[model samples]
Target: MQRYFIAPEQFGEHTVMIDGEDAHHLLKVMRMKAGDEIIVCDGLGKSARAKLTLLQAGQAEADITEWLGASAEPLWKVTVAQSLPKGDKLETVIQKGTEVGAAAFIPFQSDRSIVQYDGKKEEKRRQRWSKIAKEAAEQAHREIIPHIGEVHSWKQLLQRMAEFDLVLFCYEKEGGAAGSGIADAARSFHRSRGESQEASILLVVGPEGGFTSQEAEQALAGGAQLAGLGKRILRTETAALVGLTCLMYESNEMGGA
Candidate 1:
């Protein structure tokens, strides 16, 4: 059965109204008809098995059959704070990061960032990344679509670091240090969580050229713990996905429902 995410308001007592792009996809692209079975999610960690009942007037309606409570979200919240990379690398990061269980993405400008997002281009890039995240979340059956934060400057990034409980800075030079690996840092954060308090982690990855010593110093000064991914140096695009995947796995996200 195909899956679609609908607004919470669209879900009534027994039926869900599907409209907009989802409706168009059903009516035109998928050629779905009445009696077809599909999964509809409310995008707030609620999903149900729905059977198509009506398709008309640029909309589709489905009756909820069974509610599914199983969630794929991790116990801990992770936000990928990625520095701007060249071309479409950041897009790839948002797409795959969503699939791997990142709660949000924050693109920041670093000292070594080769690409800069100015006025018109910034808005366009934000929209593009938001769309990519939405599509990726839908395809991956994620309960919530990961938020794409606005691009931030160096100072803004540092200021925003106060929001997360823990921040893991993926530093290339720090991988050789003892207990500086992502697993070690994640374990520490996971252990520090109190009753019913989920750990919120901000995993920071630098740009194509990586962060300068001064930039790394600032991030470390802003309460970010240096974490090395591995011995091998990964590209700017690979770092976020790898970091998120590892962190999720370490937090037992893969083992959970």
Candidate 2:
């Protein structure tokens, strides 16, 4: 069934109200009518099955048939602090990263970063990235939409490192280090959190040209482990998704057969 994410206030005791763009999609694009069943998510991880009860003036209301279960969010949370890459790579990162269960994405300024944004341009870019994240979440059947953080300065990125229980820097130079592979690091994080109830991870990926030695050193000194993706170097766009996939797999979010 089609799923629509709405705020808590949109839902009454027995009915769910959907307005704005979603209503337009249902009424004008989907040509949905009364009695059609659709899934409604509260965006806080709650979902429900509802049947359309009314459609008027670009607004749609549905009667709640059943309240669904909690989210499919991973046992662990991952926030990717990616250095802004050239072109539309950031959008790709947000799109694929969301599918792989990343809890949030933060674009950061790195010494080697090629793209720069500020003022109105930055706001517009953020809006575009957020839209991509939301669409990807819906497509992937994710219970919660991954957050797209604002463009962060180098200082801000460093400051945010303290918030996570574990931090990893995807450094190509560390690829040959035994036991420091992305999968290994992720497994270690998972094991460390196994005894606990919740854990948050911060994975940092450099920009297109990669991080400078000084930058990597600073990150390492700030309690970030240099986790290697593989022997071969990966493009900036590919790194975050690969890291997120390894994390999700290690956390058992991607069921292993």
Candidate 3:
């Protein structure tokens, strides 16, 4: 069944209203007609089986058949704090990171970041990034679309670090030696959680040039545990996905017993 995320307000007790781009995609692109089945999610971890009951220009409606079970979201909420890289790399990170179970994304300006933040196009850029995350989540069968944060300054990123239970700084210099690996950090976080499953994590990945020594020191001082993906160095875009995947795997979200 094709999956589409609708706002919570758009979902009635027994039916969901699909409008705008989604409606066009359903009625025109997919040629879905009345009686066609689809899954509708609220982008808040709630999903349901829905049967299309109405289809018209720029609008569609589906009747809820049955509510879904637990979502595909990871038990541990991981947010990727990625430094802005050159070109459209951040889009890739957000897209793949959503598939890997990252709860959110925070794009920051690092000292070594080649691409500087442009206030003039901030809104447009953010909207594009958010759309990527939403589509990726739907394609991956994720009930929740990852939230994309505004581009933060280095200091702002550091300040936001205090919000998470665990902050993993992916430093290339650590490379399997300088800091605890993802598995160890995840296990320790799991143990620390005790009976609660509401833990949140922040994984920081630097830009093309990676983090400078001073930046690394500042992160370390901010209570971030330095983490190494492995001995090999990964591109800025690859690091967030790799780290997220490792964390999800360790958390047993990847079907490990």
* TM-score for each candidate, following the candidate numbering: 0.93, 0.95, 0.96
lDDT string, candidate 1, 1-257, tens digits? 68887889999999899998899899888898999999988878899999999987579998999998768687788999999899889989999999989999999988888997787788888888988888898888888888898888989989988998898999998865678898888777766764335778899999988889898899889999989988889999998998998888777777621
Clashes found in each candidate (C-alpha, N, C closer than 3 A): 0, 0, 0
Q: Please, what is the whole-model Cα lDDT of each candidate in the order they appear?
A: 0.87, 0.86, 0.89
Which should have the higher TM-score, number 1 or number 2?
A: 2
In model 2, residue pairs whose N, Cα or C atoms come closer than 3 Å (at least 3 residues apart or on different chains), thus clashing, are none
- Evaluate candidate 2 by giving its C-alpha RMSD to the native, one decimal: 1.5
RMSD of 1: 2.1
lDDT-sorted candidate list, best first: 3, 1, 2
Error of 2 at 238 (Å): 0.4
Worst 10 residues of 3 by lDDT: 175-184
What TM-score does structure 1 among the candidates reach?
0.93
Give the candidates in order of TM-score, highest first.
3, 2, 1
Residue clash pairs of candidate 1: none
